[model samples]
Target: MIFKNRLVMFLKRQCCFCGAGFLFAAIAFTGVATAQAGSSQPDVRISLDQAEQMALAHNRTLRADLMLISESKANEITAGLRPNPVFDTDAQFIPFFSPSNLNSDYMDNSAQFDAGLSYKFELYGKRKARIQSARAATVVTSSIISNDERQLRYQVATQFINVLYAESKLRFAEQDLATFDKSLSISQKQYQAGSISHGNLLKLQLQRLLFQTDVTSAQVAVVQAKDNLRQLVGFDSVPQNYDVIGKLEAPQPKLGLMDMEADALKSRPDLQAARQLILQSQSQLHLAKADAHPDLGTTVDYTHLAGNNDLSAFATIGIPIFNRNQGNIAKASAQITQAQEQERAAEQLVLTQVRSAYARQQSALQVVDLYESGYLKEAQQSLSISQYAYLRGDTSLLNFLDAERSYRTVELNYRQALATAMLSEQRLEESIGMSVPSGKVH
Candidate 1:
């Protein structure tokens, strides 16, 4: 910023000179402005929470699942509706071929006319059972959707951390390249002044290529990771050029392994969904049994023929000798047993996931601790000391090069350790069915 201001003042002074100088100043200022604008931060930057929320709102699959709930509610309405009444009307002895004989007196005296209404009423609480089954299925769907949301959250968080890791690696690569470039520059001057041999200078300059390659690889990794994260965040939810912004290292979780396992059992939606499935199956069995109970049909008729009027009533019921819905009842019973077993399996799965995630996070934490236990600082100090000694002719070039490589390796490893620890935290939270403690641990 200071350089930019100084350059602006210098350009203004030049503008006060010849018109040619003014034109040159204007061009220079335009170039500087373009560079500054290009280097500015991206317009779309999202944190982890923002990405997860956007995914939840805009993910097509999730929206489709929510639509199924509406469908289930509609099914409930259909189940609660009663059967429509059947209407019948007939005319005899004066059909279309003999329409001339169909006058009012003829229709009443000669022709016979009849009208009837019939309805089949549901028996044994069949309608109620149907409604209950629909409702229970809807409840199961809701829990399944909740579990899907939980999985989506974990997926988004994991990808967000991946992007963060890639960005951190890119930054570290650029810094490492710049630091090595400075060493190359010093080697160039030393070779010219005969302070260093030409062969040694060539080796230093050649090694700079490795640092440049690291920067290129890191850039590619960053782009790929961002693309993967964008798929989860929903492409339309964020701009194409969006960048992720968050801490590279996750904070230590406050909860222990046992606590995490207990929390998962209490909160994991998959377990809830599994338990709901059992109720859904039971409701379905009740509906199946209700289907076996045949409904009663009743009809009332009015007739007029030969100047006589008559009224009649009829009732009907199925014998239920065959096709008594035995298959559906048996299937529903089997489903109840399957659902019960699934619920038990879900519980065990939750415990296993919690334990595995907690173990991984703990291991990652220990790795991060090892890096922070002076190894990283010592590597940097060793490099700085060796570089100083080599430039002053107090040490050999091999010693300086080895120290530099050691420092680079250690620094990169430390960054990866931090990223691993943070990713472990994300996994642990996913398994635990809630967010653990976050932010800097120390």
Candidate 2:
């Protein structure tokens, strides 16, 4: 009976252990399946505005630039802070080795304890100059950060357009492939019916291969464009497929060239930053001049000697005979000249950018209009008519294929032109440092 009980207990324990192990395995499998499902979920679709917002929020470089503003503000705070007074204690002329001369009292004749406090005073408005210089530096840093943000916005906008263009190409390639598949199907039927020669059927198959190659290349291009956008938006991984939802058409700007140039000079962050640099240089020059004047230090001391208390005050001043910050003063003045020249150069560069982008924008608009107005419609109709005629045995396969290729090329070119137009407009906005009102598209 005891052996039976022991065997039964062992069997029950083993069963329990096996059940637990199976449960753990099941749980692990469920967890892994859940993870995979989550990972395979579709990507979060985003519009251009959303993408820009995300980039501004998460871009590492922009975040680092923002930190510089804080650092500059901290420097300003440091510059405005008053100098701290120093305290010192000294015990002098103590008769330590001569016991006979040494007095038992703590305040003896041969020993002296002195406590002193000293403070250095800034002269010739040096503190005010230093504070002003620091404030000007902060402005320069802030302007630089603004310029960086403007550039980042431009980058995100351009990349978003590229992704849109790539997606359009992929769609066109897929449609072309479908058309080839239909032709291949018809060719196969004709070949089997002995209505077409083997060589001709082989030629059709080879053409299908060409379209397949194009489809593969388009797919790779789309992936690369998306990857570039992801990096700009600061995404670590994008496992699911996502797409941009926006038209490739350009929004016309209402402002003319002269207005744009005026706005750029007034609002362009780089120009503002350059001007702020000039102000900073001027402030530094003032500070350098102030540094030629010396600081005065005053001290108050209290001493106890042989039970006698004495108080004294002294004043000290620095001599400005040598090293009166001549080098820094000269450098500061030269920096002001450099900053002015840079500001002028920046203005010229802005003008060049605006003119170039405007010209490209006009050219792109013309091309887009030419295609959208008549060329694309004609090519598409030609392809449709040729396809129908070939199906009814009224047209040659070569003529039908040529029409198909023409239509595809025209459509792709139209999309490219639209993308270019939109990108140029974006560049113009970046150059002007502001968004222009949308005008009627021609």
Best candidate, TM-score: 1
lDDT of 1 by residue, 1-442 (tens): 7976676566555444444543554465456447536757666999889999999998888988899889989999999999999999998888568777768888778888899999999999999998999999888888788888888998888888888888888888879878888888988898899998755775675566567667666766776888888887778998666787886774665576777778898888889889989999999999999999899999999998899999999999999999899999999999999999999999999999988887888888888888888898899999999999999889999999999999989988888888888878778888877886544332
Estimated TM-score per prediction?
A: 0.87, 0.85
- lDDT: worst 10-residue window of model 1: 14-23
Top lDDT hit:
1
Residue-level lDDT tens digits of model 2 in 50-148 = 888878888888998899999999999999998999999999877777766676574476589999999999998998999999999999899889988
Error of 2 at 180 (Å): 2.8
**CA lDDT of each candidate?**
0.83, 0.82
- TM-score of predicted model 1? 0.87
Candidate 1 lDDT score at position 191? 86
Q: Measured by C-alpha RMSD in angstroms, how accurate is candidate 2?
A: 15.6
